[model samples]
Target: MKRLWGILCIMVCCTGELSAQKAAGFKGWFINNVKIANSMRTLDLSEQPAQLQLTFPRYQAHSYLVNMGIAVILNNNTTLNYISDLNVEYHRNTLTDAEQNNFSAGYGFKWRFANAGAADYFMAGDLQYLYNELNATNSLGGTFLLTLFRDGKRLNWNTNNFRLNNRLLFNLAPFAGFQMQEILKSRQNGMAGFILRPEFSINTSLAFCKKAGPPYDKLLAIFCNYTGRDDAINTTSFKEHYTQLLHTGINYYLAYSPFEVSIGASFNDGSDPLNGRTQQQYWQVSVNFLK
Candidate 1:
């Protein structure tokens, strides 16, 4: 009787293990990737006699990024992932122009819950730090995002996940938070202006070749930003304005791998009195690794 009971217990344990594996599916892993890229641009927006476009001739910039993260499949119904990256960028223009350098660090977390049928709800958060040489300043900022969607379902003529996703890809995210600095140093006193910056972006990504082995993703996006100082400096008057930044791009991914590449261009029109009516254009290429 004792031996019979032991055999039954073993059978029960084996069954439980099989059930757990079936429920979890193929998920949960950690991966890391490194990225490097070069960019060129021209920015001209200043106020002078005859409205001179103070051309800051084409300059080369290099970036190095290190990303590391882990994702976990909590159950058949939920998933969680986290990532952190460190970025360093350097740029050089004319010899007379001062070289600029920026260092940033970012962290993000995402949580997803699967609903009945083809639908899911997700929440995410991101934080970043910026260090620059132009003003020898440091800035810290963060954003929070929330989303609800039903995959490939049309709710209205122009309302649905498809339209929303496309809008996000080429424009500002629907929900977001932002904060930053205004002035690094005061002209007379060594005072600084701590500013609050808020922004919104919307973009859309349209995928083609669904019937083919892989799909192609393209995006168009637009962003608007505003910033104001917390306290006005005595020597200099503080002003606030808005800027419109536009971008269009294409991205491609290889089969069965986290390797993907993208190419894009950005255009910016200044909306600030200090920046005058400046217009700037830039080109970019990037690689993403996930595993």
Candidate 2:
């Protein structure tokens, strides 16, 4: 009996130590934002369009994206955060055996200022870069048969098809949100349960350079809040080179002690009609390491 009790105590101690380590240093989520069909509503698995019956060669575009974030506690009331995104995209044409590939990357930093409370406040800034290359042959019985359209531009040649959008966009955002913990308790394990968190932020983007035409460059709107317009010249709400927007999100999680599996939805109230995205939203399934 004594030996059994000693072993049980050791196991408990080990478990407690592991839990503490997870809580102290780890804070992030593995979020897949572009796994399925591109839609604003649900998390659908199929790549097919709303009309699922007919699949065409021109509609063969796939994007894979991952978003990650880590937070470090600086003090009792301050935390610093780093976030990143990686994306790979491919488009294929069966008729002409043409292909277009794209890669995108984003990095951001955030500062959270809050007391020990259920709700927290933060400010964040981010940047994004994109690159695209197209590969096609000019052989169609001495006549080029391959044609591609991108960003309102038409393409007919195999060369000069690569584009590098190293625009270096910057977004500054301020956010406020709350997390409701212990919404549901587990029956068997005391440390397992459910949690709900909803957050919103206002944001503005600045691009030092200009695009070739209309539809300004914008990225990482989901991390921003209620910044005003970017039109006027000399006002607090006036952003010089870009636009202002609002971003909001809600997350529902199933917690198992230091880990959580969650489903989240986010939206951006975009106002730039020329930028192509008047409004944008998405749903994501994620595994949160710590929060």
Candidate 3:
């Protein structure tokens, strides 16, 4: 399973810096993901690749923001990770309250620092422009947050970065991050939401790479995130309070190359306002390619 452990490195790749470190120039990466829903019963199944996303980092870095980065994304419009309905009542991003889209482009900035003798830290902000053909909704939004770790790794814009501090060796790498987002504009409506997540993993550094490195090299990573969204918040309509979503995932990365695979599951905590008793759960699998 050494190969499998390498593939699972995608778990600690949350920042993309790890994956980009593996790239040659200008740090770039492409990822494809698919999700499935059990639909409250094992027999009733629905699945979709859901989406693909890529990140490109500029060659300049500053303390306020690391190198500026760009992103392109395509959504397949086939996911229920956001609601309790099988078909969906109101569409929204599974990670945030913003409306969902079929395609999108975005820009972002990052501030990175490290304490070789202690821990690692990261904070970033992102802005996106999105469009959906099916709903004809146009949107804009972004988020800012901080992450904590215990490694001596830094960002490398000229090359893909996979190197991790080998000083600290811990079996289970525990880390957490918090973020807040602004739903600038969603179609013609305004929305609000928040997400909270904490993740943990086993150090799976490629057996061939250094025996010790940051947690990203770990072969297995697991996490659960909570998403709370409300489109009608502070509005006149008292339709419902808000929607709640819980997402759990696992990923594998092969340190030998720039490739990774992942699987995820989600649970909707409320009843679909439209279909009453139709509670839903989702599953997903993803593969990523880095150059």
Candidate 4:
């Protein structure tokens, strides 16, 4: 199970970041990839809109997670968006005197279809690449045995040494949702007058990796035998495994003109679309600084 856990770590990475060059040439509106159901607002005019998240994962001593995005308006009813997702992490295992570093970056675009009343729809996709390595030593400063998967290309069996694996992955997601604006309005004199926006959406994502072969096929077989179920795996030998993710959530937006905040809970049910074994659901709070 320890070895399985290590393999799982390489498969479950997610997040994005913008390069300094990209930031300098950025133009358009900032919007969350999954939260675009209303008409474009003046807030979308901001040059750069970014999202930051901090997470605490076991054995990871330090980590940074950032998701930054920008959108360009193509017309009254259509918009184009570019987003970057990055995650950088460091892990330390005191029990084995081992350490590892992992990094991944993904950039993608989304097209917002025409909006009709309170309902909205969009089609978006992104490609992500990850590279990581591991090193370990024993009490006598001797090498410890470790094996790692290198982007499905080859396996590395070594000690006190690390190898690189740059895994290439892609995901296509479509979002459909509705928003009821002004569900609540506060009439406070001389104040920005609080307003509430309640929204709901169904999100689905299809993710796949480029490399297809052994272990990949064998891994899918293991999941099948373990789950004792069919249909979830989705692909066979030649195609390896393509994961499907289903995410549903309801969020309430509190806005005071120019500034908005949201709090919501979501239920995310799916396999680790990257062929990893990890799944989670939770609630979150977000403040839109540029809105």
List candidate 1 segments past 4 Å from native.
1-100, 111-123, 155-173, 180-191, 214-238, 250-258, 262-279, 283-291
Q: Compute the lDDT for candidate 4.
A: 0.26
- Per-prediction TM-score, please? 0.45, 0.26, 0.38, 0.29
lDDT of 3 at 182: 34
| lDDT per model vs. reference | 0.33, 0.28, 0.31, 0.26
lDDT, candidate 4, 15-64, per-residue tens: 11332223543432233322221112111111112334445564554433
- For TM-score, the strongest prediction is 1
> Could you say which candidate leads in lDDT?
1
How much is the lDDT of residue 289 in candidate 1?
A: 28
Give per-residue CA lDDT, model 1, range 1-291, as digits (tens).
243234335433533443464454423222222322321000110000010012334353322221122212122333233333332222322222223333344444445544556545555455554445445555554444454445445541112233442423222223333434444443333434555545443433333333322232433222232222121222234434444444444445444244333332323222321211122444434443222
The reply for model 4, stretches above 4 Å from the true place, is 1-103, 110-125, 132-242, 256-259, 275-277, 281-291
Name the Cα RMSD for model 1: 16.7
Error of 3 at 24 (Å): 10
Off by over 4 Å in 2: 1-59, 71-242, 271-291
Worst 10-residue stretch by lDDT in candidate 2? Answer: 137-146
